[model samples]
Target: MGGLNSNAELRRLLEEIGWSPYELARAVNRLVSPDRRIHAKTPFAWRDRGTVPRDPLPAVVAGILTEARGEIVTVDQLWPGQAHKTEVWLPAVAQIAPDRWLPHDTLALLKEFRASGKAKTHFAVSGNELTSLAESWAFGNHALMSNRMTAGQGRITPDYIDYLEKDLAELRRLDDGHGGELVLRAVVNRLAEAIDLLSDSSYPADLGRRLLSLAGQMAQLAGWLGFDLGRHGFAQRMYLLGLRAAVAAGDKQLGALVLSCIAFQQTWRNRPHDAVSIMGTVQQGLRSATTPRVQALIAMREARAFATSGMHSETSAALERAHQALARGQHDHDPAWVYWMGPTVLTSEAGRCYLHLGDTLQAEQQLAEGLANLNQDATRDRVLYGLSLALAHARGTGGRQDLELACYEAGQVLPMLPEVGSARCRNLIDTINAELRPHRATSTVRTFIDKFETMKKAKIC
Candidate 1:
């Protein structure tokens, strides 16, 4: 973790977490090897001269930052462009004592490792590993909080927290209509503003909890936007921040929601094994959850994870459970977070599951039903479901007639792409194009590609 750059990012990160050079060095030494002591001057040199430490030091420093800031911190952030040499790794060298107090070091390692390159490759996280995390969070005595807040002169009230909550709700609407790319900057700005307010203002304990919960909601929105944009690393970091905020707010529901969101995102990204692992841990974490809608959401995600793994029987069983769970849910009784959940979401997810399981007819039927229920403002989701339907038709044995219908779906999506500013939409379109490449000679396929290309040109112009 050394070499040819400025330490501005390092200094800024350390300052944000209120860690001095000596404290950081001490933390690093304790993390690296308790038997050995590293002088404070070592950190000062590295900080001042960009002298990168060798071996596990980079990962140690990252773990320390993850603990301090309650967010993921990469070696690349502390030492930019060093992944090639460092292997972009999170070392599993340390273990925590089985106490009710979740040690900062252990929490740091969990956050860092979960978002690391290794987690993506080593997708098989065992129940034992996750049980430890659950126990750490469930019985931990240490409070989870961001270091961004300190004493302030201004006063905060319940009304102010309510206003932030309303704003967060509106941001979710914007994401639905315009896609994450168009709304992410606003979400990030709002989150920053909320953190600044928390840092600069004083409030009653109850109001403080409400304000922290509001901040968690904003962080969750930001994380969702990042996931929509395919910035997986950034998305994981935001989710960690959201989880920390939720825990600090004493909002167990929000914490579980964030975990569910992460699992769903991972499932969609084709990491079904990891997704299932996360969902299992989340279930264990929320064993006493009172929200049926949340339970339904979790069940749906589990079904998707099963589908992704080609476990059709398990998928069917999970879907049945999910539908039954949803049937028990009342719209008014659900949280604002689950307001977007309903028949449409269920249908679309079921269709995606069937599509993955190679049931083209069932996929097409469910997808069509979902699309009929979808609103015009949800252009991004509409386009995604349309693509899934088109793909099912393209892969079916129904030949030329089905091909024509598939091309028709492509035509529908092409016209709406400009209105939907999602990276995911573009990626899905590219995937569809790739799937149709073998049939480019077909009249229907040629027509679809030509129209899609023309739309792209129009968008560029």
Candidate 2:
């Protein structure tokens, strides 16, 4: 062990998994090396010289073996004398199951994670893991053990619950105005506080329900911020957390909302089958509790999912249902959360679905209407739909007028990017820039690029 003895542990682990030394080396290289063609001599050297790979490669080796072996393969097992070494983050780090977590253990784990400052350091959920979490939320039968933990010892009041709600509303406003990057940490902090309050206080059952509902809302907001920041796995976990809180609070409507949020994220990830399935579950659950606006919102989301999955007939039907539901919705009867889910939002969503369906004409028409009627205060939505409209025009006939209009719409989105710190928003702009590449010779496109460059110099976008 002094110098570099043979890596007997790695050799044994590879042998146990029926993989040759070269295969193990190939897996590591494929995962770690961008070129993915590391020489087999590397593995030979490690086996003979007892050389540990680099900082993370040892962990990567363990992970590949774990997946293939269908069991937890510790780094120490893969490379002995490394028992004290931590497994650094890797591509599949999010997929690594936490030790001893059962269905009943989820709420406790979520609480413990929120209480731990270390958990805040990274966003560590993968899409597949997220889908699993979402499925559990939708169908799992585990119950929260109790709300009466000894660690929670405070006299909670209605005013305190109201204060939490107020905080949630304010944080949501910041999220809408400034994007997720600026407001996510604040929202997560508030969500943790809400969780604490739920457990720490004794109150009437109604008040307790309200507190739980507040926690659910906060969790949903946190999830939204997670998605906006491009932490899809984290977003999925947050959504499931919110769903659990909502279920515990006896708020079916809130639970449906959380499920719909997951569905939306699934659609974003191009897993339209999961998205559609999740939304169908949400719709079924919401039937008794939903307002027309809420129904419309869910229907539009379903339409988008269907469109993305190439289900043309289902997409058109869902869109029609959304429009019909919206027409029947009354502003006063809608929930506070659904207040923003108006005809304008429906138009924007319909436009999105059309774009996915490859109907640029319909996409442009609905997007234009949506933008025309969008509230001025919706900074993020404006930029998003603006970009979407620009994209629709770009994908259209590519006429001078179409291209110029696309550039104009894209340019209009620039000013707001200063206030919008969302990675998703930045990604949208990046996409628009890529879309306009072919039209670089056009003066309008050139002006758009110049303005964007100026904004970059000013650190606006």
Among the numbered candidates, top TM-score falls to 2
Worst 10 residues of 2 by lDDT: 91-100
Model 2 alpha-carbon drift over 4 Å, by segment: 1-107, 117-136, 139-152, 285-288, 331-335, 397-401
What TM-score would each prediction reach against the true structure? Answer: 0.71, 0.76
Question: How accurate locally is residue 230 in candidate 2, as Cα lDDT from 0 to 100?
Answer: 76
lDDT of 1 at 54: 71
- Clash number for each model: 2, 0
In model 1, how large is the Cα lDDT of residue 174?
A: 89
lDDT of 1 by residue, 190-226 (tens): 8777766666677666676677677778778877887
**Model 1: which residue pairs collide?**
1-52, 2-52
lDDT of each: 0.70, 0.70
Tens-digit per-residue lDDT, 1-461, candidate 2: 32357877666666787887788777777556576445787877667678777666666666666555534466677567753454243322232242322423434644664676323322233234445544554555544335443344687777877777777778777876666555888877787776666556566667766776777787788888888877754675677667766766666677777878877876776667777777766665553557788788888888887988888899999989989988985856565566577789889988988888878888999999999999888898998898899888888843423888888788888788877767777887788788787778988888887888788788777
Worst 10 residues of 1 by lDDT: 117-126
Candidates in order: C-alpha RMSD to true structure: 12.0, 7.1
